[model samples]
Target: MNGILNVLKPPGMTSFDVVAYLRGILKMKKIGHTGTLDPGAAGVLPICTGKATKAIEYLTDKDKVYRAELLLGVSTDTQDAYGKVINTLEVKASHDEIERAIKSFEGSYSQLPPMYSAIKMNGKKLYELARSGIEVERTPRDVKIHFIDILNITGNRIVFDVGCSKGTYIRTLCSDIGDRLGCGGHMAFLVRMKAGSFDLENALTLEEIKEMAREGTFEKMLTGIDVVFKDYDRISLNEKDKNRFLNGGFVGLSEGKFTPAQKIRVYDHDGAFLALGETVSDRNGKLNLKVDKLFI
Candidate 1:
């Protein structure tokens, strides 16, 4: 119960709903989802349980891949099909034009987040203000679109897969593409194909999780918290230093070549993963390992 679950979130259920459902099944209150997926979207959602919750921030910082369908000639208030149609026009752009327009966005750009979003302003969620029939000027944010692969184009519909940094709104990307093609558009469908190291193919549905739980094999579906930091170098501390490290004390490191601020996976003498530590120099310039996040 102290690991991450690669959940295949079903459309129509909010991200919080998935966490609550898992909490009821696992009967544990220490549960959290790494990132929020739109209620109308479906796909990979990593759920952290118990001590794994501490890794949520690291998990959410990873890039995401999404499969999205952009419907040209129509625009909505919410930027997705779930909202009311605010504009419509005839599709006049050619397939080549559409492709070029979508591919042109595969880089850094200032993106205006949709008004009907979860972003907060002055202690009120932007969506709350939009629901109250109010509109506010929102500053555009810098978001990176790693890549956009156009899968197919049928009439006014274009299906594409996008790899992007965190906080990149696929809906907004679709809207911008349509605008570039001279016809506004909206996101018709979306599915998160990947989130960091988690992929949709390996994700489990709620029904599958419940069945596995009944069979007493649900633990097998979990990914260890230490696995999330596998890219970092590891350091095993002796018993004497391990005790001090667990008590939030920095342990002296006389060996190992490490950068000034390099992150490392920490383990105890018996090979139990203990915490995420970073290499630091004390006042006297002595190298020491300090805990970034404690897992034990």
Candidate 2:
């Protein structure tokens, strides 16, 4: 049970709810989820179990892709369709104008996080303050919009696919596009298509997981913790070195020169995964592997 599960989170349930549901199914207490998907959006959500919980940070840092629809001419308090309407305007932008506005957001940019989001402000979650009808000034944050491809457009609704870096807010992106066109807008619908290497095509629904559990095939859906660091180089330690590494001592690397500060996956002589280590210099100016994470 020490692996990741690409769970297909259904709309209307918060991300934590999905983790809680899996906890009951697997009867494991060490379960956790990576990214937080909106309760109104449905798609791939990687759930970590057992030792896999240690990889949540790395998993959440990955880029995510989404299929979202924006409704032009209306703006909401929350920047999404679920929020209360704050203003409305005539749709004056043409199809070409809309397309151009959408393309203008490609690449790097800065954006203001919505107050209805989970971002914290002075130790209080923005949404918490918003719930109490309180508003505060928020500084803009740097976010990257890799690309936004228009899928279809009908009347005042535009559907598209977007690839963005972590911490990007698609709702704010839609609102910004509307502002560019002089007609306000809000996110009409959203569906996460991919998160890092995990895609919707490979995600399993909660019902499917329960069924697999009953049929004794649920184990097949779990992914190893090593999968998160597959891109990193690996190093094996001998009996003595393995003992030292596990005890928080640096292990010497006799291999070819590696890039400075490169992270390397570690394994015991028996081929069992042990820990994640980073190459660092000791006070004596010698390069060695410093333990970053220990699974043993």
Candidate 3:
């Protein structure tokens, strides 16, 4: 019952909504999503259940890829098309111009989270303040943009793909791209493609999950917690060493195996996950592993 699930969340349900639904379906009291996707967004949302919830922080650092469509000449107060229209403009940019604008957004850049976002402002969520007709100065945040490529540009609609770090707002990205084109824009739709190793292709929708549960095959939908730990370095521990490592001690390493001062994953003799450990060497040139977080 403790594992990870890649749920393909549909639009109109908050990230928490998905968690609640899965918690009820699986009858598991503990469940959580690795990252939050807006209620208006749809994507590969990774849910951790039972003991797997302890590894949520490791999954959050994974890169995310998105497919977004922007509608030119219209801007909404919420930045996405899910909100009321607060301003309108005339479209003038051609398809080529729009493509160029999207290219300019590629690579590292900072963005200011929109007022309608869920970002916290003075212990209160910004969206709550936005709904109350209150406005506050929101400083821009440093977000990484791996790349931006135009997928399709037909008429006033521009579809593009973006790979970025966590906390990136695709809505603001579209807004910034539109500003460079001088035609203004608002995101019409967004579909996340990848979050860590999980992708839309391998995701199970809400309907699919329920179907599987009814068929007594729901366990197949849940993945092992180690799947989410693929990004970390793996270490195989022998029985003699496993006992030592479990007691908060480090094991010796061979030359050219792994560099010192690295966070590594320790596995039991049977290849079961033990816990996360950090490796360090003493001034006397002796290597030791320190238990950072132990599970077994």
Q: Write the per-residue lDDT of candidate 3 for residues 81-155, one digit (tens) a residue.
A: 988887788888876777777887777787999998878988999999999999999999899999887777788
Please identify model 1 stretches exceeding 4 Å from their true place: 254-256
* Lowest lDDT 10-residue stretch of candidate 3: 287-296
Q: Write the residue-wise lDDT of candidate 1 on 5-46 in tens digits.
A: 999999999999999998888878999999999999999999
Model 3 regions more than 4 Å off:
none
lDDT of 2 by residue, 87-141 (tens): 9999988899999999999999999989998988799999999999999999998
Q: What is the C-alpha lDDT of each candidate?
A: 0.93, 0.91, 0.86
Model 3 — TM-score against the truth? Answer: 0.95
- Model 3, residue 100: displacement in angstroms? 1.3
RMSD of model 3 against the true structure: 1.5
Give all TM-scores, in the order shown: 0.97, 0.95, 0.95
Residue pairs in candidate 1 whose N, alpha carbon or C atoms collide under 3 angstroms: none
Q: After superposition, how far is residue 199 of candidate 1 from its true place, in Å?
A: 0.3
Model 2 residue 35 lDDT? 88
